[model samples]
Target: VEEAKRAGAKVVVVLATQREADEGRVGRQIADELGVGVVYLHGIQFSGGDEYCEYIKYTLAALVAALEASSGAAGGNGLWPLLILALSIAVVAEAGLLARGWWRGGGRA
Candidate 1:
Protein backbone atom coordinates (compact mmCIF):
# COMPACT_ATOMS: atom_id res chain seq x y z
CA VAL A 1 0.00 0.00 0.00
CA GLU A 2 2.77 2.46 0.81
CA GLU A 3 4.54 1.54 -2.42
CA ALA A 4 1.38 2.08 -4.40
CA LYS A 5 0.95 5.52 -2.84
CA ARG A 6 4.56 6.33 -3.63
CA ALA A 7 3.85 5.42 -7.26
CA GLY A 8 1.08 8.05 -7.32
CA ALA A 9 -1.71 5.55 -7.08
CA LYS A 10 -5.06 5.99 -5.39
CA VAL A 11 -5.87 2.77 -3.60
CA VAL A 12 -9.55 1.93 -3.53
CA VAL A 13 -10.63 -0.99 -1.39
CA VAL A 14 -13.96 -2.59 -2.19
CA LEU A 15 -15.41 -4.31 0.85
CA ALA A 16 -18.61 -6.37 0.57
CA THR A 17 -19.01 -7.20 4.21
CA GLN A 18 -21.60 -5.40 6.30
CA ARG A 19 -19.88 -6.25 9.54
CA GLU A 20 -16.61 -4.80 8.34
CA ALA A 21 -18.45 -1.73 7.19
CA ASP A 22 -19.53 -0.84 10.69
CA GLU A 23 -17.81 1.91 12.59
CA GLY A 24 -14.31 1.16 13.87
CA ARG A 25 -14.03 -2.02 11.77
CA VAL A 26 -10.76 -3.42 10.50
CA GLY A 27 -11.59 -2.58 6.92
CA ARG A 28 -11.97 1.10 7.79
CA GLN A 29 -8.76 1.00 9.73
CA ILE A 30 -6.90 -0.48 6.78
CA ALA A 31 -8.26 2.15 4.44
CA ASP A 32 -7.29 4.87 6.85
CA GLU A 33 -3.80 3.50 7.19
CA LEU A 34 -3.35 3.29 3.42
CA GLY A 35 -5.00 6.66 2.86
CA VAL A 36 -7.38 5.02 0.41
CA GLY A 37 -11.06 5.12 -0.29
CA VAL A 38 -13.33 2.22 0.55
CA VAL A 39 -16.30 1.39 -1.60
CA TYR A 40 -18.93 -0.29 0.51
CA LEU A 41 -21.10 -2.66 -1.45
CA HIS A 42 -23.91 -4.87 -0.20
CA GLY A 43 -25.30 -8.18 -1.40
CA ILE A 44 -22.07 -9.14 -3.10
CA GLN A 45 -22.36 -12.89 -3.52
CA PHE A 46 -19.18 -14.44 -4.94
CA SER A 47 -21.00 -17.59 -6.06
CA GLY A 48 -21.35 -16.34 -9.65
CA GLY A 49 -24.19 -13.85 -9.57
CA ASP A 50 -25.14 -10.50 -11.09
CA GLU A 51 -24.32 -8.48 -7.98
CA TYR A 52 -20.90 -10.09 -7.75
CA CYS A 53 -20.24 -9.41 -11.41
CA GLU A 54 -21.33 -5.80 -11.00
CA TYR A 55 -19.02 -5.38 -8.05
CA ILE A 56 -16.13 -6.71 -10.10
CA LYS A 57 -17.01 -4.35 -12.92
CA TYR A 58 -17.06 -1.34 -10.59
CA THR A 59 -13.76 -2.40 -9.03
CA LEU A 60 -12.16 -2.52 -12.46
CA ALA A 61 -13.60 0.86 -13.30
CA ALA A 62 -12.22 2.35 -10.09
CA LEU A 63 -8.80 0.90 -10.81
CA VAL A 64 -8.82 2.34 -14.30
CA ALA A 65 -9.80 5.76 -12.98
CA ALA A 66 -7.05 5.68 -10.39
CA LEU A 67 -4.41 4.67 -12.93
CA GLU A 68 -5.57 7.22 -15.43
CA ALA A 69 -5.46 9.89 -12.77
CA SER A 70 -1.78 9.21 -12.09
CA SER A 71 -0.97 10.93 -15.39
CA GLY A 72 -1.90 14.30 -13.81
CA ALA A 73 -4.17 15.10 -16.75
CA ALA A 74 -7.58 16.49 -15.96
CA GLY A 75 -10.58 14.79 -17.52
CA GLY A 76 -12.83 16.77 -19.83
CA ASN A 77 -15.98 16.18 -17.82
CA GLY A 78 -15.76 17.61 -14.32
CA LEU A 79 -18.33 17.40 -11.49
CA TRP A 80 -21.27 18.52 -13.64
CA PRO A 81 -22.68 15.05 -13.94
CA LEU A 82 -22.50 14.42 -10.21
CA LEU A 83 -23.86 17.87 -9.39
CA ILE A 84 -26.78 17.42 -11.75
CA LEU A 85 -27.55 14.01 -10.32
CA ALA A 86 -27.52 15.40 -6.78
CA LEU A 87 -29.70 18.33 -7.77
CA SER A 88 -32.22 16.04 -9.44
CA ILE A 89 -32.52 13.88 -6.35
CA ALA A 90 -32.86 16.92 -4.11
CA VAL A 91 -35.65 18.34 -6.29
CA VAL A 92 -37.55 15.06 -6.25
CA ALA A 93 -37.19 14.77 -2.48
CA GLU A 94 -38.34 18.36 -1.93
CA ALA A 95 -41.37 17.76 -4.13
CA GLY A 96 -42.26 14.63 -2.20
CA LEU A 97 -41.93 16.43 1.13
CA LEU A 98 -44.01 19.38 -0.02
CA ALA A 99 -46.72 17.12 -1.45
CA ARG A 100 -46.91 15.14 1.74
CA GLY A 101 -47.12 18.27 3.91
CA TRP A 102 -49.78 19.87 1.70
CA TRP A 103 -51.82 16.71 1.58
CA ARG A 104 -51.79 16.36 5.33
CA GLY A 105 -52.64 20.03 6.02
CA GLY A 106 -55.13 20.54 3.16
CA GLY A 107 -52.94 22.79 1.00
CA ARG A 108 -51.28 25.27 3.40
CA ALA A 109 -47.67 26.39 3.95
Candidate 2:
Protein backbone atom coordinates (compact mmCIF):
# COMPACT_ATOMS: atom_id res chain seq x y z
CA VAL A 1 0.00 0.00 0.00
CA GLU A 2 2.76 2.45 0.89
CA GLU A 3 4.54 1.37 -2.28
CA ALA A 4 1.39 2.08 -4.26
CA LYS A 5 1.29 5.57 -2.81
CA ARG A 6 4.91 6.11 -3.69
CA ALA A 7 4.14 4.90 -7.18
CA GLY A 8 1.43 7.63 -7.48
CA ALA A 9 -1.66 5.49 -7.44
CA LYS A 10 -4.83 7.57 -7.02
CA VAL A 11 -7.24 5.10 -5.43
CA VAL A 12 -7.22 1.95 -3.38
CA VAL A 13 -9.69 -0.90 -2.89
CA VAL A 14 -9.61 -3.04 0.23
CA LEU A 15 -11.28 -6.42 0.42
CA ALA A 16 -11.43 -7.34 4.07
CA THR A 17 -12.23 -10.48 6.02
CA GLN A 18 -14.69 -10.63 8.91
CA ARG A 19 -11.95 -10.64 11.53
CA GLU A 20 -10.20 -7.74 9.86
CA ALA A 21 -13.53 -5.96 9.63
CA ASP A 22 -13.91 -6.25 13.40
CA GLU A 23 -10.35 -5.53 14.41
CA GLY A 24 -9.96 -1.78 14.31
CA ARG A 25 -12.06 -1.46 11.20
CA VAL A 26 -8.97 -1.97 9.07
CA GLY A 27 -10.44 -0.97 5.74
CA ARG A 28 -11.68 2.41 6.89
CA GLN A 29 -8.49 3.02 8.87
CA ILE A 30 -6.35 2.24 5.86
CA ALA A 31 -8.39 4.58 3.71
CA ASP A 32 -8.08 7.35 6.28
CA GLU A 33 -4.38 6.82 6.71
CA LEU A 34 -3.80 6.79 2.96
CA GLY A 35 -5.95 9.87 2.40
CA VAL A 36 -7.09 8.51 -0.93
CA GLY A 37 -10.34 7.29 -2.43
CA VAL A 38 -11.26 3.82 -1.17
CA VAL A 39 -13.86 1.23 -1.96
CA TYR A 40 -14.54 -1.13 0.92
CA LEU A 41 -16.67 -4.22 0.38
CA HIS A 42 -17.49 -5.69 3.73
CA GLY A 43 -19.99 -7.97 5.54
CA ILE A 44 -19.36 -10.80 3.11
CA GLN A 45 -20.09 -13.63 5.53
CA PHE A 46 -23.73 -14.07 4.61
CA SER A 47 -22.99 -14.43 0.93
CA GLY A 48 -23.09 -17.87 -0.74
CA GLY A 49 -20.74 -19.31 -3.33
CA ASP A 50 -22.94 -18.29 -6.21
CA GLU A 51 -23.29 -14.81 -4.75
CA TYR A 52 -19.54 -14.48 -4.47
CA CYS A 53 -19.11 -15.62 -8.06
CA GLU A 54 -21.70 -13.12 -9.21
CA TYR A 55 -20.00 -10.40 -7.20
CA ILE A 56 -16.68 -11.18 -8.86
CA LYS A 57 -18.29 -11.11 -12.27
CA TYR A 58 -19.92 -7.76 -11.53
CA THR A 59 -16.65 -6.35 -10.25
CA LEU A 60 -14.83 -7.48 -13.35
CA ALA A 61 -17.43 -5.91 -15.59
CA ALA A 62 -17.18 -2.65 -13.67
CA LEU A 63 -13.39 -2.70 -13.95
CA VAL A 64 -13.59 -3.41 -17.65
CA ALA A 65 -15.92 -0.49 -18.15
CA ALA A 66 -13.67 1.81 -16.16
CA LEU A 67 -10.57 0.75 -18.06
CA GLU A 68 -12.27 1.16 -21.39
CA ALA A 69 -13.53 4.59 -20.44
CA SER A 70 -10.09 5.65 -19.29
CA SER A 71 -8.27 4.46 -22.41
CA GLY A 72 -9.52 7.33 -24.59
CA ALA A 73 -12.38 9.66 -25.39
CA ALA A 74 -12.96 8.22 -28.85
CA GLY A 75 -15.91 6.25 -27.45
CA GLY A 76 -14.33 3.00 -28.61
CA ASN A 77 -16.68 0.28 -29.82
CA GLY A 78 -14.39 -2.44 -28.49
CA LEU A 79 -15.74 -2.39 -24.96
CA TRP A 80 -19.37 -2.79 -25.92
CA PRO A 81 -18.57 -5.87 -27.95
CA LEU A 82 -16.55 -7.32 -25.09
CA LEU A 83 -19.31 -6.51 -22.61
CA ILE A 84 -21.90 -8.20 -24.79
CA LEU A 85 -19.76 -11.30 -25.15
CA ALA A 86 -19.15 -11.51 -21.42
CA LEU A 87 -22.82 -11.11 -20.59
CA SER A 88 -23.78 -13.76 -23.10
CA ILE A 89 -21.25 -16.16 -21.64
CA ALA A 90 -22.46 -15.53 -18.12
CA VAL A 91 -26.05 -16.05 -19.11
CA VAL A 92 -25.32 -19.30 -20.89
CA ALA A 93 -23.21 -20.61 -18.02
CA GLU A 94 -25.89 -19.75 -15.49
CA ALA A 95 -28.54 -21.45 -17.58
CA GLY A 96 -26.44 -24.57 -17.87
CA LEU A 97 -25.84 -24.63 -14.12
CA LEU A 98 -29.54 -24.30 -13.45
CA ALA A 99 -30.34 -27.10 -15.86
CA ARG A 100 -27.73 -29.37 -14.30
CA GLY A 101 -29.01 -28.65 -10.82
CA TRP A 102 -32.56 -29.38 -11.84
CA TRP A 103 -31.50 -32.65 -13.43
CA ARG A 104 -29.71 -33.61 -10.21
CA GLY A 105 -32.92 -33.34 -8.14
CA GLY A 106 -32.24 -29.82 -6.93
CA GLY A 107 -35.86 -28.96 -7.56
CA ARG A 108 -36.95 -31.51 -4.95
CA ALA A 109 -35.66 -29.21 -2.23
Candidate 3:
Protein backbone atom coordinates (compact mmCIF):
# COMPACT_ATOMS: atom_id res chain seq x y z
CA VAL A 1 0.00 0.00 0.00
CA GLU A 2 2.82 2.40 0.87
CA GLU A 3 4.47 1.38 -2.39
CA ALA A 4 1.25 2.26 -4.21
CA LYS A 5 1.29 5.68 -2.57
CA ARG A 6 4.87 6.23 -3.65
CA ALA A 7 3.82 5.28 -7.18
CA GLY A 8 1.24 8.17 -7.17
CA ALA A 9 -2.02 6.32 -6.50
CA LYS A 10 -4.18 8.35 -4.16
CA VAL A 11 -7.46 6.50 -3.72
CA VAL A 12 -8.14 2.99 -2.41
CA VAL A 13 -11.43 1.12 -2.67
CA VAL A 14 -12.34 -1.90 -0.62
CA LEU A 15 -15.30 -4.00 -1.75
CA ALA A 16 -16.59 -6.54 0.73
CA THR A 17 -19.59 -8.72 1.47
CA GLN A 18 -21.92 -8.00 4.38
CA ARG A 19 -20.40 -10.75 6.49
CA GLU A 20 -16.92 -9.43 5.81
CA ALA A 21 -17.69 -5.79 6.48
CA ASP A 22 -15.71 -5.78 9.71
CA GLU A 23 -12.60 -7.04 7.95
CA GLY A 24 -13.16 -4.54 5.19
CA ARG A 25 -13.11 -1.81 7.81
CA VAL A 26 -9.43 -2.54 8.01
CA GLY A 27 -9.06 -0.61 4.78
CA ARG A 28 -10.26 2.50 6.57
CA GLN A 29 -7.82 1.74 9.34
CA ILE A 30 -5.00 1.30 6.87
CA ALA A 31 -5.89 4.55 5.12
CA ASP A 32 -5.89 6.36 8.45
CA GLU A 33 -2.62 4.73 9.33
CA LEU A 34 -1.10 5.91 6.05
CA GLY A 35 -2.72 9.35 6.35
CA VAL A 36 -4.52 8.78 3.06
CA GLY A 37 -8.17 8.27 2.12
CA VAL A 38 -10.32 5.13 1.79
CA VAL A 39 -13.69 4.40 0.34
CA TYR A 40 -15.40 1.27 1.53
CA LEU A 41 -18.42 -0.51 0.04
CA HIS A 42 -19.87 -2.82 2.62
CA GLY A 43 -23.12 -4.57 3.59
CA ILE A 44 -23.53 -5.70 0.01
CA GLN A 45 -25.46 -8.94 -0.29
CA PHE A 46 -24.41 -10.79 -3.41
CA SER A 47 -27.95 -12.10 -3.93
CA GLY A 48 -29.28 -8.70 -4.94
CA GLY A 49 -27.49 -7.90 -8.17
CA ASP A 50 -29.06 -4.68 -9.45
CA GLU A 51 -29.31 -3.11 -5.99
CA TYR A 52 -25.63 -3.79 -5.50
CA CYS A 53 -24.93 -1.84 -8.65
CA GLU A 54 -26.86 1.16 -7.32
CA TYR A 55 -25.00 0.98 -4.02
CA ILE A 56 -21.68 0.92 -5.82
CA LYS A 57 -22.67 3.86 -8.00
CA TYR A 58 -23.60 5.92 -4.97
CA THR A 59 -20.39 5.02 -3.19
CA LEU A 60 -18.30 5.96 -6.20
CA ALA A 61 -20.08 9.30 -6.54
CA ALA A 62 -19.42 10.07 -2.89
CA LEU A 63 -15.78 9.16 -3.28
CA VAL A 64 -15.42 11.42 -6.29
CA ALA A 65 -17.00 14.30 -4.39
CA ALA A 66 -14.59 13.78 -1.49
CA LEU A 67 -11.60 13.80 -3.84
CA GLU A 68 -12.78 16.92 -5.62
CA ALA A 69 -13.36 18.69 -2.31
CA SER A 70 -9.93 17.75 -1.09
CA SER A 71 -8.32 18.94 -4.31
CA GLY A 72 -10.18 22.22 -4.13
CA ALA A 73 -9.08 22.83 -0.55
CA ALA A 74 -5.44 22.01 -1.33
CA GLY A 75 -5.34 24.12 -4.44
CA GLY A 76 -1.90 25.18 -5.63
CA ASN A 77 -2.79 26.74 -8.96
CA GLY A 78 -6.04 24.83 -9.57
CA LEU A 79 -6.56 21.54 -11.44
CA TRP A 80 -7.97 22.66 -14.78
CA PRO A 81 -4.80 24.33 -15.99
CA LEU A 82 -2.69 21.44 -14.79
CA LEU A 83 -5.02 18.96 -16.50
CA ILE A 84 -4.83 20.95 -19.73
CA LEU A 85 -1.04 20.99 -19.64
CA ALA A 86 -0.91 17.26 -18.99
CA LEU A 87 -3.38 16.52 -21.78
CA SER A 88 -1.42 18.70 -24.20
CA ILE A 89 1.80 16.91 -23.33
CA ALA A 90 0.15 13.54 -23.82
CA VAL A 91 -1.23 14.57 -27.23
CA VAL A 92 2.15 15.85 -28.39
CA ALA A 93 3.94 12.72 -27.20
CA GLU A 94 1.40 10.47 -28.95
CA ALA A 95 1.75 12.44 -32.15
CA GLY A 96 5.53 12.19 -31.98
CA LEU A 97 5.32 8.46 -31.39
CA LEU A 98 3.02 8.03 -34.42
CA ALA A 99 5.34 10.12 -36.58
CA ARG A 100 8.35 8.06 -35.54
CA GLY A 101 6.45 4.84 -36.20
CA TRP A 102 5.48 6.10 -39.65
CA TRP A 103 9.12 6.94 -40.39
CA ARG A 104 10.17 3.44 -39.32
CA GLY A 105 7.77 1.75 -41.80
CA GLY A 106 5.40 0.85 -39.02
CA GLY A 107 2.52 2.97 -40.28
CA ARG A 108 -1.12 1.68 -40.45
CA ALA A 109 -0.30 -1.98 -40.25
TM-score of each: 0.38, 0.47, 0.41
Evaluate residue 21 in candidate 2 and report its C-alpha lDDT on the 0 to 100 scale. Answer: 57
Flag regions of model 1 displaced more than 4 Å. Answer: 1-22, 32-35, 38-78
Query: lDDT tens digits, residues 1-109, model 3?
Result: 6786686555556764522576567777766766666655554544555443345445545555455554546655365564555556656666676677788985653
Span of ten consecutive residues with least summed lDDT in model 3? 50-59
Candidate numbers, best TM-score first, in rank order:
2, 3, 1
TM-score of 3: 0.41
- lDDT of each structure? 0.55, 0.58, 0.58
lDDT string, candidate 2, 35-54, tens digits: 65444444443365445447
Q: Which candidate achieves the best TM-score against the true structure? A: 2
Error of 3 at 6 (Å): 0.7
lDDT of 1 at 92: 69
Instruction: Give the clash total for candidate 2.
Output: 0
Model 2 lDDT-worst window of ten? 37-46
